[model samples]
Target chain A: MSATCHPSDELLVAYGAGSLDEAASLLVATHLALCPRCRAEVGRIEAMGGAVIETLPPSDLGADALASVLARLDQLPGAPMPRSPVVAAPGLPSPLRDYLPASLEALPWKRLAAGIEQAILLQARGIRARLLRIGAGIVVPEHGHGGMELTMVLQGGFTDSGTGYARGDVAMADQQVVHSPAADGGETCLCLAVTHGPLKLTGLVGRLVNPFLDL
Target chain B: MPDKRLAVEPGPGAERFSDLLSAVAQYGDRQAFALLFQYYAPRLKTYMRKLGAEDAVAEELAQEAMLAVWRKAASFDPGRANAGTWIFAIARNLRIDMLRKEKRPEIDFDDPELVPDPAPRADEVMATQQSESRVRAAMSGLSAEQTEVVTLSFYEDTPHAEIAARLKIPLGTVKSRLRLAMKRIRSELGDDQP
Candidate 1:
């Protein structure tokens, strides 16, 4: 972030409030992972959300809400889908990874770079999310997004433009602009990326590979 | 207006999110997982709304997040962080993913001149603004530039990035100002402890 950033207090608020889209969510998380300053700001806003909740007037439940929940319990064991293998991060901005059906931390990850590796944990809706590892001094190509791409840095450091990112950071791209990310040396940059569509390569080779990468 | 969106009494089975997460992980019970979903879904919806996402989009994200919870139920560990903190981290990361990177400028990390002073300021305006009125007043204390970052982050629902493009101040500044404001507020609150 060069004096400015994509996530602001309001966005953090909305993020705390759950108004952001899935595509954008990844980007902010990537940024937050690296920038501790934003992380603190987000924490404050979340507190404000609690304050707002406290200030709100109370309303009664639907009488059978508890019973309904309890009744629904029995059917849960037979849920239509298999237990989804969600990756559980150790820190902030966590999502459904809370109920992951398996131990993702133990999975075998393939190296993409020195510190960058990826474990393709799950895929659905033409979107595939995998864990990425980026070691220090590593620079990814400066490229634009395709349709939607979600990335979360689990460890180490990476920076794009003027903003530096660290563990727990997430970034989302949506064919809006181009960026080249490089990891801070000596630190391992572990990330989780979800590609909603094929990636559109930039630069000359990007153009040539665009046909073959099929991403 | 915020109140209108939430359910009262938090419905039923009001247990801490951490509790439910622990139960599922240690016990391998699906019911524990269900309790966690019922506990968080509506609040998660409200959170999505605050992010300025459409209800459907928010709902979908929330569902996806929840589904992840279903799948990841076995890994909940209570020692590292509480359940709310952990889930919040996940949801927060998920939201961060949605923001797109605009035109990324080349960064010269070698030049110390380019980086904002990394010093953490303790007495920024946001800290002084403890009450609602104080908060509004504190906004006046910031330069219009700082105020914009604050407003966009706290109100506009735009991610930190769009704020950079809209203001052209650079993403680092946006993060720094926010950090300063939050630090100030924490100090202000801390001063009252005695």
Candidate 2:
């Protein structure tokens, strides 16, 4: 099914403008793989970039830039060979395939709590992207975000404050939102999450577990 | 719609570029490729420069972007995107690859699991003919504050938080401006079809 929840227009604009950092871009790209609506939105945004480029006063290239490009053009094949299609792990999106193991069961999952496990896929420039697997019917500790956090469900589903997010649904949280999310019963819920800053777990349980978890 | 049409005349120049790219794709026309290089290379250099590349690196990347255009010309679909939009995407992707150490994960069109958009309407197909001009018209309609944010966000590598700091505005304001700007642009493009 097509994704019902999407990243905000602001995020999609950043993705189209090439301004989003690598980890965030990976998350948004994976969502775009399942979302045609956002893809169309990004197409319009890129067209705006083209329009802006057309209006910019030209800057002079090196004197022989055109000649240099022409020289190299001759060496290229008349037409580029069609790229071989990428083979993603079953049930995994293509964008995530490279960063993950062949299957979810093989991931180097580190336990964060009795019912929670995570595998960090990438971290850079204060941003982190990871995979979270929550045991069925488990309620994650209530937490507030330090900055923007984006979570997209890859398998099963979760409910936050009475709202359900199924596969391909994105849940965005920031400093203002604090809630405990519970994975639905009958299946382990797997999610790909990208965060810009640290997450602050609240309450006594959170306080006890917070220091031990490196999230 | 009439006012938008008046604001920006249909870009004959844009259509011409599309033809030139098609010629390169169909027959590997060197002269056509040269014309494209002449128009886009310097602008692309400016794009790289605005993104913080020094002059030499910018020049090199611009050349690389143009070379990519030639190699990938066969993949260019004039029915879906005009030449400027197509080249912009190429240059944007090249900049990401060369400037950033991290990989930019992209959707593979040929992936078996890929979901496709619903079929387009006839009007939507016709809309591609003047998409660049329509975008220009849409851009002109944005407020100055919205335009400033959009321009910086597109031309610079600055993130939203950095843009907020640079402009001395709150991060929330920056996001709102972008959201409003995109809403205006979308409405102007008549892209609100369900």
Q: DockQ for the candidate 2 complex?
A: 0.54
lDDT of 1 by residue, B1-194 (tens): 22221222223323245556665666655555655666665555566566676766766666556655655555544442345544554554455555332211111222222223245434333233333333334344566655456545533444566777777878777778766765555454323311
Report the C-alpha lDDT of model 2 over A28-84, residue by residue, as the tens digit.
888887887787788788888887777776789888888878888878766545443
Question: What overall lDDT, based on C-alpha atoms, would model 2 receive against the true structure?
Answer: 0.82
- What overall lDDT goes with each candidate model? 0.51, 0.82
Which ranges in model 1 have alpha carbons more than 4 Å from their true place?
Answer: A1-7, A21-40, A54-117, A121-129, A135-138, A147-152, A162-164, A168-174, A184-188, A194-198, A211-215, B1-194
| TM-score: model 1 vs. ground truth | 0.42
- Evaluate candidate 1 and give its CAPRI docking class based on DockQ: incorrect
TM-score of 2: 0.90
Error of 2 at A106 (Å): 3.0
